[model samples]
Target: MNTPQQTESIKNLVENIDKGNIVLPEFQRDFVWEIKKTCELFDSIVRDIFIGSIIYGKPTFEITVREIDTRPRKGQGSRRKLKITSFDKGEINQKSQISNFRLILDGQQRATSFYRALKGIDEIWFIAKSEDDLDNEIKTKEYKDRSLEEMLYTFSLQEDEERISIKLSEAYEISKGDMFDEDIKENFFDNLLFVVAMNDAELKDNFRRYKTLCMKLGELFKSELLLSYYLLNMDNEKFALFFERSNSKGIQLNFIDILAAKLYKGFNLRDKIDELESRYPNFKFDREIIVRTISYIVSNGKDIDRNYILSNLNYDHFNLYWDDICKYYNQVLDFLFQEDLAISQNWMPYENMVIPLIIFLRESNQNDFSQMNEWQYEFIKYWYWASILSQRYSSGSNEAILQDSNVLKSIAKGIKITDRVFFTRLKSQIDSYEDIFSYSRKVNVIYKGILNLINYNSMGLTDWNNSSKLSFSKKLEDHHIFPKEYIKQQFKNDEQAISLMDCVANRTLIPKITNIKVGKKKPSRYMTELKASNEKLDSTLKEHLVPTEIVEGLYDEFFNEFIEERAKLIFDLIKKTIIEKEKQIIDQYYLAPRVQGNIKIFATYYSKKLEATLDVDSQKVLLLGESHSVSSAADKAKYTLSGKGDTSTNGWRFWKYIDNNGQERYIDEFRK
Candidate 1:
């Protein structure tokens, strides 16, 4: 039997492959063909098979070869696919109709080898009539000979009837001839052949065997096991849908979603209150406590308004007493987790308390609680509520027990054992309460109390002692009480001697030199000077002090009324100091300014002239009397910038005084 021409046979096999008529599953990874390896493989086959002129079917093969497709299908689990395309019988016809020939699967390597061999050259290798040694049917006396004869008969027979008995194998073995290099056995021959293929059944039975072979040879010869396909291959809509499905991981989880999930998972509350809380993210923090407490409260069919219960209690109360509540929660969660405790609703009752309670439990150092007092526990609870409700009223971690002494004092005053018990009881008392209302009221109370303590005037103006080596007299200062501008405004109505003299309310004990420098500048402009002078002041106060820390702490508002109240307090203190100073002078000397009223007589001289001048009335007084009479207009009281006493006619002779009460007095005559 004469097989068809090799070209016609190979053409039929190529057609079969293109039409998907032949299914070749990948037995290794996808085509990783290096151009260099392909070149080498091509050169080897040409040198060994074509050049040697040995008919391909004869054994004693030193090199091995195989062929497998490298493309992958979508969703196939393996990383490699394999197919057979050639055999030992003959080369395939490249143009023959594949449907007409019974393709013996073993020749895939041979066909590929022959095709690549012929493709690189201008002429294809053909068996010549001159190589007559193996052309005749010479019988060898062995069973191997019979098997070889049987195999050859399958392809040699020209008639279909004679080919029927040949048992065709699905794989082929080929020789390296003299082309096998020891170093290239694994790197070249084994990789290109045996490692390239394993049928599906063969792979399942012996994946270890082929995987090891691939490991030794190289990955290039292995078929693609994992199938990967891109959405771009599909139509627009399918492409979009596929992309969306693949790109689902792109959406970022927001903080709330992430935090909520953590709370839900860590405590196993998915079916419990977390499910309900998921419906409204805004109420998550409040629901952290309310839902579980409500579930626990309502389990026994008690009629209570959820809103009313939350409204009366306030977050402060909860913060102070959440631990006690969690003790009850732990019982509930432990029961739920272990025994599936009977809950009021099909709702997972355990979740409500576990999330926040577990959070608290983990936050609290268990061993240290033994030494903690009731007050400490209450303080911790208050801070917790403060953090959860107002998003942290005091500084530090959300769970830190407030260590600031002032904060501790403020919170301690607000939360008492009585208030704690009452709110807990109130949880059961009210028909409906809002968590937000309770939370707001609690925060408002705490914030207001803190503000009050900060603004309290018990420290008084004396606290501005500047004991830290700070001094207004030297450092430059201004009155914070009633500014000079305010005095000027009031001065518009009253310019009388008393009114023009700065009013008691207008007085402020400040750095003296600075006050003198500022003089009558508008308070707004002077304020900039004052702020610039005080580097120790907080930057917020660098522009304005009255509305800064002092006023911000002292008054809820810095409007006129509040300013007036602070002014009154300040002026009262100033007036008392001025009165005491006047009394001291009066008790010391009758000639000095009287503590009786705001008046004092003083003497002066103008060059050679004598005059008794009434100098401006200030906190300080200077008095002088002279011999000049009331009727003497010639010497109309010339005043001199003289000190306590003058040597010109003795200091008293230069000035005279007529008392306001009609008492006439001369300086020298009175002294005599």
Candidate 2:
């Protein structure tokens, strides 16, 4: 049955969404409107244009529901309390007991867009009288100078006598008049340029303009009746049929959304994913990766594409392997951190690489890289480099990834297969390294991979001016060796100059502080200044893979030669770091007839020494009448020395021995 149509002010509608009086059905698709669409909704609202009508269903039977998307207030927990109603269709004597909440059947996107904007959920929404006014606000020293293109609402302001704009949320609050907190006045003043104004007349003019904008926004939210809805009184079957019919013309749900809806009866996939995201707040991999990973594991490496997942994935299988997936995922993160492959999600070249890695880690049953045998460790390392350099996962790479996963599984079982076409492709890709350019680190996998390789080779990049180590703790950026402006001045064609300037060979990671010092200056000048300030300049430059011989002559005349020489040098470093290093480890520890080493641990309170013998072919260590890998041996020593457990130590770097020339060196030095 149809109820009478009703209209609600935008302000009341937003308040209902915030207070949980309005919610969404479990089967409903998520809010998928892009920022542009959300901005357009706001534009229409301010212009007093009718957007559309919402449909709300009052369920006579019990149904699963979720709250509207809104940012949680301070002290609120991870999730809002979900409302579950208990009712029998025949037992309801009065219409008042039906339920206070209504399930949104239509206009979900429009309602969510307005709610999120008004509540300042993901990004702050603001309105200005003119583009010039917004531009002026952006020019204020306090503004971060974000790109207009990146913003949802594109507007800019110049320094003008009149500057007026109000944050949408604050406008809504002020529209309440007596309910507005007096303390919020200061915040409103701070959002404008009046905070630093010296003249009282100018301050009054700005204040007057601010009030006008706020009042306009307030009127738009309070007086304008923008939301109209049709209330439906329907049973479960009818409601389901109506929902299906209503959404027929809407955007189709993706596979993940369908999977979520199907699995919700047995296991709440969305809740589990939300829990995982809460656990690892820094992880940036999207929901697809998580779902695909579960599907891949449950399918036993058969296929993890969308069709396979949709066809075969079930709640029982997902619940069974979810814990192991989480554990292996953590190990993959640790591996990336320890190897300096990626400091964070933004630096990762191919995030899908996590799929194969998780697979390998689970099949091998290895806790960490330090516990791996030489062959297992080397194979994974080679595979990682090859996949990234060859862009193996760039496009339709599901088959390639499946094959690689199979290979990794075989290697875990001690079978070394060398004749794969992937390796040949990897070799060809590496040979063409110089042709790759560093356009955008966020988009270009090769550029990031090359930077990661350089960081791996250097162990850690060093500061250019100061000899301090560059870590993720400090702000790091990929900077050009020869300044961009200098290169532009050298070449008559702008395109050629930018091409040469942004080459992967010409870029290196340095601390942001160092980059400021090297700004727009010729390499020769910066190198000269750096050499004078730091005693170990040559060594630091070498760590960044910058050839010292070319630094002085890196002007326009020698630019091509410099790039060629540096590209070759970088290739050599990559080979030594990824390829030659693994082989050297195999030759030194696994294949060698005999090898011995001792690790000395010196603490503030005590000192101790441990001796170990490497077992050839197995890569296990013999220490204290027990067999262990070098990593376990080191862990044992650390526990003994520090009286603490849960020590994850890299044994190769910890263990050391004397060589033929009577020089002491780390066991890992053998890889050199």
Candidate 3:
């Protein structure tokens, strides 16, 4: 229960560093440090200790001593004292205590060299030995020149004279027979200490002090010994914190940090996601999207509250999500790689499209999204985020929207639907289905916003460099369709007339070269040139819209008709798609459904602002309408004054009614 403090001395600790005795904990890394780094570490320690440079500033290292039953040699068993040193919180005790107690935690190369050199193997030798033996073979710089010293330093040996009698295991010489050459030994030791000194000084001065310590130690110790502190003595909460804070130099750790430690041996998670995403270069989502998608799949598509889902996800539950990790990975594969759903000619609004992908996966019998289930909510999420940011910066570019995690989170929470209605105060006139149909067809401003972009850019400009520019295939550059000169020419002396040309609806993109080519031309002339040089257009225009041939046939009259007809068509298409999607959502989910009937309908007294419902089929000629249809009764209505039945009947009249909470109340004067 007591908090652990860093152990101070190599003699006071009691962990066995026997190769067989050392056990790597499930949470620790495998023994991955190489000979070069190990050597450098030892050199840094000796240089600092002897040169009095406390390169590693804060007394961060500690070693403890422990006694264990010595191996039963050919003769007998004895209690041997083990010297275990703590470096970077990992304990590396002496495998078998060498006799004299001159411990070097940082300079492992020098210590290892001393042990090997003294064994007196005839085939292997060191530089600067006190006495030379002709029988001891030393490596030469060249076969002709044998001047390189093959002995440990004269000063080092003298300094350790008193502590020099320790006997190294006989196995050392047997393993390194004839392999220890002078150049190899020198280069290895020099690099080891250089890194240690650099690491030590860097840690003390930097913000990443804790992380540097862990990296240095993980490099120095084998996992079997390192795991003792991280797993045996550490609590889960504390361990999670430690693991997160211990990432390498440049990595910014997150929930995926812990997962890395857990899955390092089996899967390369980041690489897997990166490779998968390369397939969908158009794909856009933060790290959280991947985590959430897997969580949803693993939970069997449980409709968990949005907030709860994110909070509960962690490395521990990763196994729960593992079942679908492969599936999600593969589906991402299908969408990105196999389907080639790149952002070349098609622009799918991800906010509304990504959701469908998840629904596809959840409802399908197959592990991946079913072939029948089109890209759903997940795909919409991707498109929506991209579009939201793209639309936000239609005029300019700022990463403010891109970096705002909150906006992305809002996207994740999704659209919050309600049952509020429009026609609540109703004394109806024509309460019939046919009347409702007439009302549904009315054009509204809401429809305008949705369709105008397509009409002006997609349809009207089809003959004028008409590409799949409608898809927003690349970075959006708002183009001025009726360039400034045209606006001035069309409206000779009106300030407000030219101002309308700057609206977002008029701005669309063309290939920069094409835009420049068509510069300053009349809309008709621009259309003609664009039609002639069709090579520079998008390949998928036909798929997203009607035939290019049809667009060509109507090119002369398209821009004019586009202002009146195509815009409305686009708006209607948007409305129909939205309504159908909403209904699909309600049918597939919406656990509770309630109806309210205490409502009435009212019509506006003047102006062309038609109420949410009321038939305008027989009426004609009017101003603009509502932003969009609102009534629970009829989808839309318009006010007009020219056709057969306009001013003759009240322009504002209710045909049928439904309440604010989705309850129908058909007009029945007979019942009253």
RMSD of each: 47.9, 30.2, 34.4
The whole-model lDDT of each prediction reads 0.30, 0.61, 0.32
Backbone steric clashes in candidate 2, count: 6
lDDT: the better of candidates 2 and 3: 2
The candidates, ranked best first by TM-score, are 2, 3, 1
Highest TM-score: which candidate?
2
Backbone clashes in each candidate structure, one number apiece? Answer: 70, 6, 49
lDDT by residue (tens digit), candidate 2, 1-672: 367777777787887776666788877875655444665566544433456778887776656676675533212331334344443555322332543567789989888877876776634345342221233334232222333221223211111112244567666777778544335546665545423522344345445545555666677677545554334664332233234334446754356776778788787988887888788765544667777778776776667766567667788977888767876787787778777766545667887888777777777777765777876876677777767766666544565566677666656666544322334434424543454432233356677888887777777777888788776556677788887777877654644455566677888878777888887767877788888898788898898888886456545456767777888887786666555554443343232213335333221112455566655346566777788866577677657655756544445545656533222334543321
Give candidate 2 misplaced runs (Cα > 4 Å): 1-254, 418-422, 432-442, 472-475, 493-498, 528-534, 549-557, 574-672
> Which 10-residue window in model 3 sums to the lowest lDDT?
157-166
lDDT of 1 by residue, 23-75 (tens): 32233233332222233332222122121111223222222223334322111
TM-score of each: 0.15, 0.47, 0.31
Q: Lowest-lDDT window of 10 residues in candidate 1?
A: 161-170
Residues 1-672, model 3: lDDT tens digits: 153432221111112223323222222222222222222233322222121111111222443432122322111221122233333332332422321122323423222332222232111211122111211244212212333212222122111111111111211322233434344233332232212322232323221322222223222222222112333344333344343444558665654555555555655567656765575565443444555455544453432222234345555565555435445544643453223332322233222223334434444434653443232444343333323322322211111222122222222334222211111111121122111111111122121223233432233333235544333234333355555576667555654344344433344434455567757665555654666667644343333232343335443323333233323443344444333344454443223223233223433222222324222331222224433222222222322311111111111122234433232332221011
The C-alpha stretches of model 1 lying farther than 4 A from their native spots are 1-256, 259-271, 274-396, 399-672
